[model samples]
Target: MAVYTHVPAEVLDALLTRYAVGTLVSAKGIAEGVENSNYLVETTKGRFILTLYEKRVAAADLPFFMALLDHLSAAGCPVPRAIPARDGTQIQTVAGRPACLIEFLSGVSPTTPTAAQAGAAGAALARMHLALADFTGARPNSLGIAGWHQLAANCGDALDRIAPGLGGRVADELAWLDAHWPAALPQSVIHADLFPDNVLMLGDAVTGVIDFYFACTEVRAWDLAVAHAAWCFDPGGTRFDPALSAAMIGGYEAALPLSDAERAALPALARGACLRFLLTRAWDWLNTPADALVTRKDPLAFLNRLDAYAGGGLL
Candidate 1:
């Protein structure tokens, strides 16, 4: 989603030689996200995505991601599968970073998603949870509660530089979540970061759910909570959309119903979701190079959501 390392045309052509994909005609750097270097590559055969893993994505986690894609694809979930090279390897070296050629799915990431789109996304998320029920791989979430504390410490008092009073609020929320987070919930492999940009939609149908880099084993309802926080908000995170929330939850329940305990624990789970993004965005906002190809996201967007969730009117 971002290009930190630049790959030349000749190097890309040579890399494609290891695969049956074809000659590279053009490759453009996608500079939207902060985690990896991505390009939309066109070859004689077809169009595909070229990703060079950069910050945050560990090389050790590549196989787990590839396997998850393959599993989901085989299970008829709408996910992009990693295209293997002729040598039968999906992971290869591109610009000295671990890279992969992925199946290109066609659909635009909605900017202002409609209720129908939210419903479809929610259903797709549930389908993903059901499809992965048999997946044996397990990777603990590195950005979970403990990581939040580490990020806050790493940020220290500098968080207030982004916004007045932000540091104290983050610290207090971490402490409160530590005391109140659910002890036990149904856990599974989840796409922990299911923001609208990560989901590709065509009309009311979900054609692709991309960006599994943040995917990890966690509480199942927590995934829904993340989606709720991401989808049911205005761009500035100032207004709540009740219709979107109802449709999303309705769609999810149609596929996989939540347990009574899960229902009761959603508000807290949602607060955790808000803090997770707030801390990470604050970390990225402070640490990412100013000259980097990616745009720094504002951390306060989720702060607004955190404040809203704390008001106790929402689910």
Candidate 2:
């Protein structure tokens, strides 16, 4: 099972009472994620995920994350609905960190998604973006250009060893981005981390999408680009499945057609998307605390992706 942090039986009992979620039958840490502490809570009422937002998640942005989930749930999207506390607030403090409970979305994240599965995920993401088009709030990008640079700074010493010329190449790429990154595009709420691990599936259908801690307001196309980086390429990144990529993009376009400008900028956005993951993984691999039980994801996986995008003639 997963190792949870500092959760006492009394605190679990208190949460059960506050939410009227019946008796807490069991509670254990969820093992898949690396960022936050999650517990799978089984109550007489049902199963729920109790999240202890780590320091990486900004407290100020908690409202946006909760509100977005509530909004998406109302829109018929298969996202977890945040359960309110006894005080009727969607958020509360637990273990001195922002915490909330969400109805557990049943289904496992696909280990290897088929082409049709990728299409469905893309369609669902498009529908989500459309649903949140009119949402009247904003949250700073947790993994935006600035965050990317900060991560790069932290991992500067390791880049040369991880991938030749990666350090200088990324520096140049950032310089170019500073001059040319999109000032404006179709803005909406986006699931900035739409990786396969966060998309849960049951049989041939997608049951739900989880982990909205990276949600933010940005060019909607950037979300698509991120999804592309995750879904379109394999780990080594040499193999390109055009059919899968096309299916996903096709599904998305069917829901909300991409504008000419959005299409034009997608390639560059995909490059940025590639670099974003590469830098984060590199930093995490180099700096992960020795005591942390989480395994650092491979930075080379994303570097190979960058090489692929460069070779594929970007979009």
lDDT by residue for model 2 (189-294), tens: 7999999888989875789999988898888899999998898887666677787789889989999899999988887788788889988878767766776657
User: How many residue pairs of model 1 clash at the backbone?
Assistant: 0
Over 4 Å off, model 2: 1-4
lDDT of 2 at 87: 79
TM-score of every candidate: 0.99, 0.93
Top candidate by TM-score: 1
Q: Where does the lowest 10-residue lDDT sum fall in candidate 2? A: 1-10
Candidate 2 global TM-score: 0.93
